[model samples]
Target: MLDILIKQVKVLDGTGNPGFIADVGVVKGKIQEVGFITRKAKLVIDGNGLCVSPGFIDPHAHDEGCPFFDEAVLNKLSQGVTTDISGNCGQSLAPVSERYWKENQSVHALINPPECMHEFTSFGKFLDAVEKKKIGVNMGFLVGHAALRIAVMGLENREPSLAELEQMKVYLRESLEQGALGLSAGLLYPPGSIAKQDEFVELCKVIKEKNAIFTIHIRDEGDYVIESVKEAIEIAKRSGAFVNISHHKAIGKKNWGKVNTTLKMIEEANQDGLNVGFDQYPYNANCTYLNTILPPSYLVREREQLVMNLRESQFRERVKEDILACREKWDNFVVNVGFAGMLVIKADKTPDAVGKTVSEYANALQKDPFDTALDLLVDNHLDVIAVYFSMSDDDVETVMKNPYGMVGTDGIYMKNKEKTHPRVSASFPRVLGRYVREKKVLQLEEAIRKMTSLPAQRLHLKNKGLIKEDFDADLVVFNANTIMDNADFIVDSYAPNTGIRYVIVAGEVALKDNLYTHAASGQVIRRKEF
Candidate 1:
């Protein structure tokens, strides 16, 4: 007897193998049988004309706080993502300290964790709360280096003292003991920006000891991308921890095609006995805080102080000079992509600014584009989301073709938002539709492997990424011929994709006929003993 059964589905078993016709049986939340199943079941699906593969695993996700608002995280589930490796880019919702809450509350808000999370002081407590919410997809998290720094020392721009460093290590070790998958460093953002290489190496030592992974959003993705890649590799070498680069891309026009060099570097490192890999979104553009256009010094300041600095004439001139100079000290988004390339997607105080480029908005206001961007940030409490059209399509394809590469959404979601990166709701299907099916950039099986087994191997989830008997029953069924991503940059960015027919999590049907079943069958995937 089976709890649920599917008959005559074409199975792509997440191993980069050709598809085969088979029947799959599920019982007790695990895959019970495959290949010509003759079983009785409570629920049966005629899987004809559909391909069933292991449910996609999002290797790099930013959904750590999304469950607080929408426990189902329907946007991701709708895309066939059964598991999310969140707490990437050095931001998590837990291990909150009174100092962090008091001084760095705005920074904390960037991850969008609920205010009540501040009351809990440990990563385990936060995970417990999320589990209690009965989320719709399994979630694994990494202890965020920035959160750790803020917890011990609030937004300080210098290296930690030895005692302070040990405290961070203690917090990290405790989090790992309590089920954190690993540690993630957003070196592109502060206090992660302030951290020196030694800080990462020391923290990664803890990660290595715990048999966990280290994921980093490197310091620079523009002019200094090669150096940043080297930096990540060196950290892995020093700490002997597996390092995964988050949302890997080469931004800016002149910096296009740098991924070729970086990918070679990653391969060389791996060949030399260093574990290094990367996750990438399919799009050429990237999204982040609007204030990233300013220098790193301004980013570390409090919201009010940053707004005051922006308002001052002398400070504004100096800031303009720095951005215009295109100094390589940090990633200067404005100089790289230009105001026309930066579009405001979310500006709560200035709704008119949403969906308009900084240049376009500036023209309408008869103001300098830089000033207009500054005003939006100020008007919105320094929390504006913008998408930058910076990468090359060629580079996007090149990275996609890499054998060591995997897929990630790097999707930023806001509750009750009218717009977001299409990757939030369409990454998996877009890969299948545009890249695999339309462009033939990758074979269907290989793309599924990247989304499934490869990331599962990285996260060390032994059971979730394959379709073998006795594995967890997380699967996706879709029509290969009609699968396509409809989400676009200008219109209906949040529209659900087509061709995803059924999504099952832990033997429970969470999505059927492209609609959510509102099932809460997902579990909190903790660190496993290797």
Candidate 2:
């Protein structure tokens, strides 16, 4: 007898092979049988004609402690995601001091949910808390280099002292030993961007020794994008560690079509004995806090100096110049200031803001976009912003078709919102529904493989990302023909995916018959410590 059984399902198996009609049985959270299963169970689901595959895995995300801890999880589950790799972009809620939380509230608010646990001192403690809390989805984390730097150097974007470097290495080694998959660096973001190559190399060496991986959000996303990627390659080469280019993209019109050259470089690196891959979102525009796009030097000074500069004439003039360049060269860099500036699909803000554009609010206020952005930044102390732009559909398609690429939403699973990137709610389904079903960019098996087995392999999980006997019963069932992503950029941002009928995490049905049960059965997944 099995704990549960699915009857007459079309199985994709997460291996990119042809699907076959079969019955699957689960026992004690692991797959007991697949193919012809003559078994009895406590629960049996009639899965006739429904597709069963290993649960999807999101490769890059930052939904650590967003508005509510489980706010946006439904969207992900409805799209068949049983696991996700968050704590991305060199950030995480754990291994953080209470003082750091208070001081960095500005950047942390956008992604950190209220239930975020901070009682952990080391990576092991963080994992322990997750297990105790029973977090949603199987969670793997990247030890953020910036977080470590801030823990030691107080957000100073400079090379660490020899003593400070040693302290960071100790923490890095501890995290890897405790189950962190690897280290992630956000080179374009502050603190991380300030780290010199020598400073980063020292940390990467420690990661290599721990038998882990290194992922990076390169230093530049504009004209210097290639050079930035090259820097990441250089790090991997010198460190002798596996590398993943986080959310690989060339933002703005000027950087379009450069992906070909970028892919070439990645292939060259692969030939050079370094395992390299990248993750990408389907849409074109990007989102982050309002402060990220500010002039680099504006953030270099102390916080007191930062506030003073905002009020200074010289700083204002420099800001005006930078705004002009952004508008001229990067006009698509729209402002999503405060709750009212853009739609609030995931936050606990008023419903009116969720789908409205920043331009709409600025027009009502009779102010320039840049001025409006500045005003909001000042009001919120530059806490957060969400921007949208026109990314070439061709570029998105090309990246998805690449053999080395995987999918990510870059958005969180917030439910009570009006305006939001459909990616938050639609990324996975859109891939299966739009790209694979409608556009036929890739085969269904190939797409499923990209979402499941590939990511599992990258993270090096021992029992996850497969649908074989004795493997964890993290599975999804959906109808390929009826699948559709209901979220859109300009409208209906909170709409759910259409075809996912059930999602099983660790043999528990988290989403059943297209509705979420709010089951908090997921555990923190750590790396194997050798």
Per-residue lDDT tens digits for candidate 2, residues 122-237, read: 77876776566545577778888876777666676567899989988887888888888888887766777678887778899987787777888887666667887788888888
Candidate 2: regions farther than 4 A off: 66-68, 97-101, 104-107, 113-118, 302-308, 311-314, 323-354, 413-419, 490-492
**What's the count of clashing pairs in each model shown?**
0, 14
Global lDDT scores for all candidate models? 0.89, 0.73
Judged by whole-model lDDT over C-alpha atoms, candidate 1 comes out at 0.89
lDDT of 2 at 390: 36
TM-score of each: 0.98, 0.90
Q: Candidate 1, after superposition: displacement of residue 96 in Å?
A: 1.2
The superposed Cα distance between candidate 2 and the true structure at residue 324, in angstroms, equals: 4.6
User: Model 1 over residues 1-530: C-alpha lDDT tens digits?
Assistant: 89989899999999999999999999999999998988799999898999999999998888888888888888789999999888999888768897676554567676677878777589889888888887898888888888889999998778899999999999999999888999998987888888999999999999989888899999999989999999999999999999999888999999998999999999999999999999999999999988888878668876688887787889888888888886645778887899999988888899999889999999999999988988888788887899999999999999999999999999887788568888888999999999999999999999999999999998889798899999999999999998888887778787878998899999899998778898889889988777
